[model samples]
Target: MVSLAAALASLAVGKASAEDWAGADAETGQIADIAGLVRLAARFPDSGSVALRLLNAQLAAGEMTAALQKIVVLYSRGYRLSAASEERLLDMADADQAAWLGSLFGRERQSIEASTVFATIPANALLVESLAQDPQSGALYATSVVSHDLFVSVGGGEWRALGLRDAAALTGIVRDPRNGMIWVSSGDPGLGSEPLPGFRGLIGYNPAKGAIVRRIAAPEGSNPSDLAIAPDGTLYVSDGLAGVIYRAAPGAESLEVAVPVGTFRSPQGLAVVRGGKRLYVCDYRYGLAWVDVPSGKVNRLSGPGLQYLDGIDGLWLHGDALIAVQNGNRPMRIVRLVLSSDGKSIESARVLEQANPAWTEPLGGTLVGDQLLYIGNGQWNRFGEGGAPDPDNPPGPTQIRALPLGK
Candidate 1:
């Protein structure tokens, strides 16, 4: 008797061949070979042309159970079938299969409101992470995670690509409102390529000229993740791997360690508080911490029942509240945390958006006017082992959604 583990293992690595379906008709044989078909489907979930044929075979043999399960898993893995493939699936699906699919992907079927969705323009790159609104022109700019390009869009306009030179892994962006120069954090060399003497800090870009004006390098062997600009134009960057925060002036030639190592675990997002006297930093998994600018003393901020602060990627300060895009949480959500009078601790927090339909690896966002414009669907999971988006299962259009501020 085959054990369940062995059966699953066999299915995982098994290969299906033409001889396996020789006896049965093309239709019946495909569905009859359930285990083999599933194995093929699993290996090629992104291949719409492949998955659609398998689904048809399963339908031909009345194998709805296996087909249903495969469909759900493929969708979860970021598979969007072609129009013809989708029509076939819908036409062949039974009431039960249709109901299950509807319940699972109902949110995606509906159109997101234009007001809430700032833009639905397609970008040249995928896996977009950080967003910054041009306060002067009302244009929104975004940086790609896996691609080395920046995108800008006017109010409901098309997204124009601005290529970056020698910079990969662009993570965060913030426009210096004082001078309109954009500050972007990038690990241009990419992971494992570090230790090669290269720039590993911020890229100062002139939006008007659409060119990089300056490249500020961080300490040797550092990967900067998120960035925050102080009221006085001081830049605060979190080095997730180095476990330190680096500080630099806008036009400074070099970066100096601001918060020494071991201050926080995997620090990501940062927000400089009012008066520029202190800074709030999210340690990714260690909740939130504040550092006194005068002393550089880092202290954790706790609230009632403060247990975990895992998965906080984008942190923004609005008035006295801290808006956090907590994608690490199961189902993911956007939270509004009100700080105490002293700005020392979180008094309370409320869910602004929870179990949201638009969330797909929510990353960074910025406050624009009265709305919080964020990357709604990053589609980071669409990348295959080769680090490129799978052509067979192409992602849908990227969306920049706006959530009302103070909500």
Candidate 2:
């Protein structure tokens, strides 16, 4: 577990953009002043990082009552305090407060038991981002961030690289259910060794031929991150750097903006729902939102039980619910958010996995039958300047976990 101060500092230097406010406040730098953090906590009430920072500030200022109030609110939202945080609160509390704190800590849920490993990738496949599985043949394909290549594993056998031509730091990949063609999102995040001069868009690969058949370029200045395919063959891609969502029609040659800029701060994951009428997008800094495909109207998903939807990286629709991989949250978790009838609000949320012993950082996944197979140990932090792997501290073998979604 990361210390409170270190977490606060990490949130302070996050990406600066209109939609990048998931953890930090509005200002670009650290919010050391109590008044600023108070406003920040109010703005993002569900953010555990902001609440912890404000609590630390209050304790440092000798405002015990305010600190206790924040703790109560956090507790109500199912946020657990770290061991160090609990000790600090206990030291400042009176007898009644101390007793309440003890009870709160006692009720903390134990870590979910580790899931079964479905497959393991060798160390060469650096920073695997997203995954796709062929429903008919059980062939698994993974996208790499550092290597800018696609890897394939057949029948749970050894992983081998399938070279992509002129690709730049592959992010998202999905199999088009209509025609069985594999689609992957390609973008230059300034991390790859070989920079492709004038290409940042989607690549359509035919797995049977082992070749890329079609290529569609995104608009200028776009870093497409995640891909979602609707039932009707329309493709949706999220641009994390430009704060836009692009859509390409069934046979269109180029991509068009579905949700324009200034809408989301940094969109990461996308899920199409309601027979392709609605699209759910996960903004890394903001929470979850759904867009009306025809009218382009966006609505923020809200409910009494939908508290920590801000930090999700990968999202998939399973029946009426949404399974999210939330690597951005503290003590990163995999959550299941049950939706309402109309898909406008989240009815309830359940933590499927948290504090797992196998996680370096869970990134993206795809639904395979009754299980969600995802990248269990995405070593994104192992990369240094210019997205190069550190020779001295090389990443270990990557594990992909199979998390069962029980009926």
Candidate 3:
């Protein structure tokens, strides 16, 4: 909120141009005085863009309180918020119910050309006699960052439940190759309508404790669908809802942003293409798309069998192409896509397997080691199946199943 005096002063400036807001690099060097922006907006009155810029400025400065306040102001003024913006604002407020407001409301750096390799899982957990298991024997599994003990399940059998360090939504969990510490993302575990103010990122999990004892800040509003690790240890996580990709490395303070920058929309399943720095961003509905780490641009792969590859939730680099898990109850199928050397073209894609009619659901998945794929098979109607899920807590049950990708 700006003072009457400052508001009156901005009235003199009249209008602000594109030059008014700094680039991602120099923006922090610019002042994050929300009051000043508000003043300028007061003068222009038609400064919806200015208000949004101010909001982003405040966010970069860690002034979430001011940032969110401005969102409310913008909304009351009929400022149409994008999904990404609305989600972040709601995530900051820790509002779950606010998610229903999606229709209304609602980084980067470096030049690393990415490559990808694929993995396989023939079957997700086929619920036989009411039990589930992991695909990879040594795979690490945690329900979310906000649970009991961080559970690391080895072998394709029932998992012993463990809790998380804090109450952060579990985005993507991957075993860090360097130290084997499972890196996880935690933020306002995006669950309810009213969000919790002061909510931010937190991480944990150590070798000895088998849980995250220390936490850190992660990028906001990511229900990370898939986790990818570069040979260089560059960490990548995909936000299913925001269509944004978050990059991080070991011992980094904050995460970095990637291309198509949520400016595009709806990327659920993501993976690194083998032999290159190109990351494939599979849309919630579209087929496999590639993100050039250097240019920060995205190119969608489509044609013939590649067409209508909807509800892709998981991606992996396999051999000369990429394999994806189609997320749907009826339209369920595990498909494989071959990429061209140019990286811009898709040669062919095929459905490797389909879910059994009896057990009709699948979500995100991962291929374990050399032979198996672990599918996070979800339950009917509820989240986690057969659990004492508190209304305040999510009961989204998704069991890990072992599928043979090789055979």
The lDDT of model 3 is 0.49
Give the Cα-based TM-score of candidate 2 against the true structure: 0.84
| Ranking 1 against 2 by lDDT, winner | 2
User: How many residue pairs clash (N, CA or C atoms closer than 3 angstroms) in each of the candidate models, in the order given?
Assistant: 0, 1, 50
Question: Whole-model lDDT for model 2 versus the true structure?
Answer: 0.79
TM-score of candidate 1 on Cα atoms, chains taken together: 0.68
Q: For residues 1-44, could you state the per-residue lDDT of candidate 2 as single tens digits?
A: 33333323443222112222233213412687899888865555
lDDT of 3 by residue, 113-198 (tens): 11121222221211111111233335546433334233445543455545553444454555555555555544433445554333
Best by TM-score: 2
Q: Give the whole-model CA lDDT for all candidates, comma-separated.
A: 0.68, 0.79, 0.49
In candidate 1, stretches whose alpha carbon ends up further than 4 angstroms from where it belongs are: 1-115, 188-198, 391-393
Give per-model TM-scores: 0.68, 0.84, 0.57
lDDT of 1: 0.68
Which candidate number has the best lDDT?
2
